[model samples]
Target: MSHPPMRRPPIFPITEAQLVSLFMQSFAFGVHALVFAVCMHRWFCRFQIAGLGTKSWPWMVVATSLFILGGVDVSLNLYDNIIAFVFFKRPGGADLQFETISNWINIVRSVLYFLVAMLSDAALIYRCWIVYAHWKPRWAVIVLPTLLWLGAIVCATVDVYYVSTLHKLATIPHEKTLRPYLFATYLMSLLLNFLVTGLIVYRMRALSKQTSSFIRQQRWNRLKTVSRIFMESALMYTLSVVISAVMEMISNDAFYGTTDVSVELAGIAFDLIIIRLWTENTREESRTITESFIMEPPPARPRLNSLGHYQLRFPPPPSRVSFAHSERGSVHTNISKVRRI
Candidate 1:
């Protein structure tokens, strides 16, 4: 049997500069992940769970746990990205085959991140709705969350499709067409994330302004504060978005470095920061509620009102007043007679 012609080895085309950048990105991701995990855990334990106890302790626990899970999932992605950079380079073929096993690993990891991102987004959406709550249509509430969940699903689908296809792009030859589509998908997902967060902030402000009730206003202010934290956390991802856009323009590996390492790390950091903020605020809210109850006096009963003073027990009404003029006249007559004598 004739042996097949020896094929040229795949080139992993990269320079020392690119390797250095990738390493820097990996280091940044690792450090951020560790920091986030530690800080977020502390935050959840200290503030989030305890704070949530005021409104709905059970739900708060669920949300806090979910938030932590999301943080951890993203951290895992950062780790995977670092590993991929270390072992796999585009120019030089990695010892491990790209399509055979690596693709599967990436797919699984991406799925996890997808779930996490979706859950975090959903949690935020739920909280926003809670804050904006009133006589809103049932369908409206259902629709918003459903839409957000759909966005998450779409993002995950696109991520899986494109990331998995990346390995077979060489063999399939048609994979080049998918690149723009992949970019579009990522952009859409990012946009959705930004838009959803923006909506929450906007709604909170609007509700705050429209409400006439003092109680509602107080709640709205709390939501507004939370929204601010959320926005700040989101600002980190905004950097990621900008960096990713610039990278897309440059087509340089360094740009990729920003998205995978720096941006990811930054996003994780913001998440932990927000979690801490939420925890602190929750504790403060609970304290405020407790203190208010302790300080306020109970309403007095209506029966407590007396003619002269307020009392708890009922009292008889005052009797009518009568003049004592005859007695005064008799006393004056006796004094006049004595003076004449």
Candidate 2:
């Protein structure tokens, strides 16, 4: 008896893009959270067994904090999307269109995600410092990574200023004043990733060459593996950033959601350090086990028992024997007693 008036399509069909971003982000978050849990457990367990030292233990705390923060930020983003789809919109009026990408919630979420990246990048810089601190020219080696880290943070801060003040993201690239900062932020992040990753790889390989022990070489190799993983990860996220930025800059559409990949990968990179740490610690344990098997001492030679030494020859001074012979039978000799030996 009653029918609601039909509503026409809105100006934008970014709903599909929004949905794609939402579920992909959610899936990446869930997978990395699970990985973080597993890696955290293994990390602590291996640390306990393998002996947690001063230098690496503190970094472990930092890594955990970054992972936790990234998870929290992503959770907020998912909730923001849930609100957009489930609660914030009317069914018929202006609800036909997807939520705008530049909502305050999205802005806040993006800022937090960037904070996580900043923390991860800072950790990378710390690693570079520790690796090169003892070198001939220490501060000179540190200057580049330090600058990259600070530059990324500063650019992110400027970008955050814009994000906080605006409610729509599409206008960000066109705003002549803020556009350069936005581009610089992503560029700085990419640069920081490459710089720190290269430093780590170089330092670790150099360490491997300097150390004579097989175990130490293995340890360096493990650290180098972590650097490579993070580098690859950084490249992935950097590409996502590039694509999203390019698409938005050129297309004049509000449907570019590929930047979500960068958010997901940033979170994963933090937990990846833990995963690699666990691997390195377990490798040390395995090396110990192998060494034990190879370097065990030989068994001791026979010692004196209750009877006497078996090595020396013994001579009998006197002995008594009895011989018994039977018809059509073989003779047998039995020794009764020995007088001396």
Candidate 3:
């Protein structure tokens, strides 16, 4: 996916374009690998914080699955490197043609890449549902995203079926069959990110509007960090997918190879956000715990007795008698209100 096949590398000497493309692949893969490690570490920290009993278990699963997919991509890259070096770059290599570049592993790698994207998007949709849970007619807000998720799944299934059964190398199941799948997957993913982030912002805004006290306002201010992270991450990932799709569409004809790694950016986007979230969330939690401990109420002390014995003490001598008058000069004295004079 990183390399576009508009022009082939030289048989005698590699062209500047080839070098650049190679560099791009290496750089993109490096970024992908680095982010994958970060995501795993950060998600594991979150897992520890969330515990098995909480709602974070599913998130951990999704993150781990994405990490696994990254590993698979690395493995595929390793094989691709071996093939490219052995079969493509050799002085008297095999024909510089389709069989030389394409392989069945490409199918596996592409499908897995798409699978990770689907998983990431699915998690975002789940987040949207969680955010909008208080909305009446719950189905109204979720139905569209739910349907979109289903469409993505159907597209993925078709992609897997077509890609997995490929007989020719460097080939796909007709564009008509593949376009809908790729289009739906990427488009839905972007929409899901936007929708989820929007819902979260709405909730935050609602809370801000309802906040009355200074303390609550401070809490909302702290939460603004969380909201900022959500917005930036969602926009980042959505934009990455859009750029990747656009580059692919444009480069399919020209094969610039510079921005072909945008697919890898998708995974990188999630890792960065999740890491920031884990960091910010933990910081907020620790702050709350510290505040609670500091503001805790003091313990009540027991009353003391007097007269050199264990007798309850009464301080006042009851010098003033109390009276209640109901719209009359005549006083209505209450004995219960009078103290010992």
Candidate 4:
């Protein structure tokens, strides 16, 4: 008869660096979420109060909500540190069930990231509709929006595919060839974002050409506002790419935890930008309108006691005058004859 001994579990795989990153990521998310919420609230509430338009409000809300969801999603991932600290221990002391929860949290986070991307595309499309209302070049008005919608579909599909596949990879054994493609998919998304924004900028410029100076200026100002927001997103997108690319080159795991952080940072930054820019643009526009009203020339006062009829102010030159003398044969001769008689 022989006796068997139980085995002990391994130590946590996370390094001290990962722990620092997690804390930083959560802290950044908190700060970003606060700023974005403030900006979005101010913008949407302004429109709601103005009563002129509410269309942008709904889209803004949806977009901001996605960003909020994204922040929440990332924050949950940071919670993994706690789970690892608490539940993971020597063999038989901790349950594998928590690992399943962790995996699910990851899936949800990816989905939210995808949603945040989708909402950004949606917001851009809305902007295109606003700025490119007249950017009709044969069929752009129809085709542009269609392309935007299609881009959303494409982005969502790819993200879903990647997330689902990666999730399944954990359970089912598969060829390791698909790993790099996951990162490639991420690049495709960044490209989509960049393309959408560039198109908007081009169309804005084109649309500006067809408008009055004032409206054109307004649209250009809007362009700058939107561009700033897009730039924020762009910065995050680029950083995420760089980090992931470098991770790939060096075969490092730093990107695994940090990519999401990059995204969350970008989300918050963009959302705050959207809110602040929208609010500022609205105020600037309103001020422009108010100033126009204030500085408008007074209604030309009508001259009092004015002769309405058209009259020549000067007489014409006199023509040469000829008066002919007429002979007056009087009856004086008859009167003289009668007096003599």
Model 4: per-residue lDDT, tens digit, 199-243? 655654443343324243654455455555666655665566567
Q: Write the per-residue lDDT of candidate 1 for residues 315-337, one digit (tens) a residue.
A: 44334322245433432332222
lDDT values, one for every candidate: 0.51, 0.59, 0.57, 0.53
lDDT of 3 at 171: 23
Segments of candidate 3 deviating more than 4 angstroms: 1-54, 88-102, 159-181, 212-215, 251-263, 296-341
| Residue 281 displacement in candidate 4 (angstroms) | 2.7
Model 2, span 6-101: residue lDDT tens: 965534455555566677767877877787787667656655653444435665677567667657766675676577667765664222323343
* Steric collisions counted per model: 7, 0, 0, 0
Give the C-alpha miss distance for residue 300 in model 2, angstroms. Answer: 2.6
Q: Which ranges in model 2 have alpha carbons more than 4 Å from their true place?
A: 1-12, 53-57, 89-102, 167-177, 212-234, 251-256, 302-341
TM-scores, all candidates, are 0.56, 0.72, 0.67, 0.64
Residue 227 error, candidate 2, Å = 5.5
User: Model 4, which residues run further than 4 Å from truth?
Assistant: 1-13, 91-102, 137-176, 209-229, 296-341
> How many backbone collisions does model 3 have?
0
Error of 2 at 140 (Å): 2.1
The residue-level lDDT of candidate 3 at 79 comes to 62
After the best TM-score superposition of candidate 2, give how far the Cα of residue 251 lies from its true spot, in angstroms: 4.7
